[model samples]
Target: MRQIDPAFTGQPTNSKAHKAVDPAPTRWQYRMERLWLTPMFRAMIRTGIPSFGFVFLFTWYINDPVRIAAMIDWYEGAVSAVQDRPEFMVSLLRIEGASEDLQDDIQEALPIDLPLSQFRLDMGELRSLLVDLDPVLDAEVRVKSGGVLLLRVTERTPAVAWSYDDGIEILDATGQRVATLSDIESAGGLPLIAGEGAEKNVPEALTLIAAASPINDRLIGLARIGNRRWDVVLTGDQRIALPEDAPAAALDRALAMNAAKDVLARDVRVVDLRLPGRPILRLSQPARAELKRLQDLERLSLVNTEGTQ
Candidate 1:
């Protein structure tokens, strides 16, 4: 008996060409396949204890002393290249100091034949300092044989400094402490501010004075008082007391008073504007004679007016 053709019987025949065409993966499936194929993950072993052991042994043997030394040397050379960059020099004017110390420290920390793994840049602390000095730093760290570590860096330039109990700490505009001043000599002519909260308040005072410009130009130094108020020392050795609260207004009032009274010429030692109602003044001893002379002139004028009437 002849077999019936299924196609003719209204039952479709199954053919290789007619099967669901799944030629290539969907975009999602392709991404999923690639995700597990990452170099780190792909290198991991899925099966066999011996295979894993063999891989571990091979890597351990290959990373032995001589190869590690070579890697360390290569990294050291890279570090030298980084340090030699002109931008690095500009960013870190004190690079010579930090690098000089770092060189001695690194040599002591690692031996010549030591691997990169033995060396460390102390980067967590050092990196932020460098970055704060210059934000453009592109430092990278690597370790080699016997623990030899290397640092490749780009550094930054320092602007302002903060005076803390620990010492004067250099900082940029962002207030990140960069480096500590060594002694009075190393600190040079940079503005010196003292007191517990001087670092925080001094900057704000400077900013406010800067905003006031030529009016506040006579200000020579600022002192933080009672950890709450600010007192200004003018160039003429005159002291101006500012209230803890209304410093700006007090400063403006001082400027206006200076213009009107010429109090500095009158030999006033202290101008206390801390109280708004009454301005307190301390007259210098030398001005006592002048004060008496002015009073005598006023009394003579009053007598002459009464005599004429």
Candidate 2:
């Protein structure tokens, strides 16, 4: 046998004589320490865990279509509840610059019912409907404070009453139609115009009527002759032919002659002013005979005077 060392001998060793031995780390703990030192592992712990949790929640939420639809419905209902409050509701419609009839028509054309929320009303569509009326020139729609739907309109004004084969049409100053009437007599004091394209020449016709104001009350109507000239008709079915050019001047001249010579009051059927230089008069049968008789008497008086000399 080999010689036994004193440390291996089964004798009491001094407490401070042996060196202290350190405990070795286990395999799993050593591996965990190494992983914590890596940059990729540290980055995954910092960012990857939160990302995975968010993705899991998102997938769970999207998997149920009915729940998503119910959430949307709840959101819409909340919005609608806020919008349908009494403060935002339109209970009355206030119309300015419109007649009673036009107001009725506007009410008829409205797309929404009264006592409804203003949030549901489309102002552009409302304005378009109001503008479609013949008399409405322009329309403006707005919501005012105190829950009022304000509609301000500009209406066409009737300037003349036109009479054609169909009926009477009321026209504005711009020759635009305002309304239609069954007869010219029902159009109040507005001057009557007849024949095609007469409404377009209303300004000239009005000028002519103004020029002949002295006999205006006795005037019956004005006619557009072949769409070129005007014929001023009097109460007794007498017609004054007007020249296409300088008609207002010719009318003034004719009225001046009538004031001095009583030309119009005489038994004349037609006063022909188509010729600028010469004015011709067509007399009734009785007036023609009387004129012939007067001429014969003047000639007889001249012959008797010559014979006596």
Candidate 3:
């Protein structure tokens, strides 16, 4: 500042008084300090730079067709190396609690080949497929050590032989069909039942057969009449017509009568138990003829004796 004596100048010089120096920081410096204080900005400055550089270099390197193909091949090769391990492969299927025939069926029905990766086998789908078989009640599938796939199952047992017109099918205790039979003798000792809807009412048929156990040797089979009633068929072409309700009781009554009066042993074609109290006996053709002849002979003897008197 150039100062002049007050005496030289009359009152004040034409010099602008210097404004009080401003104490605040410059605009650019303040903005830079504010940005540095922000946590996100600091983090971006520290980590984002290296991340962006590495990503850029990697993308540029893999942009070529050859390099891209090679990278994909390396990934696939690594995955194959892990998946092809012996522990991850299934070489043989071990079936437990299944018959030889059923095992054969499973082996033939499986959609996958052996030596496949265990990861490729859907356990839920495999179990469902096994349970869908007629004989399989339930099945459990699992992967075991030594590259084996184990299947445990429960098989249904044959309870009765259902004889339809076309063929016979063996059924379980719940009337579920198990398998078709080649012949009736193949049913072992299972009782045979046949009629319009006998297969549907197998439980009732079984009950009736059980009630007729006394005459099992003479029993041929049970015939479902009108899909509602049962007719106990026996040898000699005889039948016991049973009522719809209380059929077992009706059968018991017939058995009791036969035991006492030998009704079943006689030439009776049918014992009609449909009516509650009185049972009508329909005689065979030969028995009816002999009965009519005997009645005529008695009438003629009475007439001859009266004329002589």
Best model per lDDT: 3
RMSD values, in order shown = 16.5, 8.8, 5.7
Displacement of residue 125 (Cα, Å) in model 3 is 1.2
Candidate lDDT (C-alpha), each: 0.61, 0.89, 0.90
Which tens-of-lDDT digit does each residue in 236-300 have in candidate 2? 76889999999999998889888999988889988989999799999988889999999999999
Go through the candidates in order and give the clash count of each: 19, 0, 0
Best candidate according to TM-score: 3
Alpha carbon lDDT at 145, candidate 3: 85
> Candidate 2, clashing residue pairs?
none
User: Distance (Å) between predicted and true CA of 251, model 2?
Assistant: 1.4
lDDT score of residue 185 within candidate 3: 91
TM-score of 1: 0.46
Q: If ranked by TM-score, best first, what sequence of candidates would result? A: 3, 2, 1
Global CA lDDT computed for model 2? 0.89
- Name the weakest run of 10 consecutive residues (lDDT summed) in model 3: 12-21
lDDT of 3 by residue, 150-238 (tens): 99999998878988889999988788988998899998888888888888888888898989999999998888889899999999999
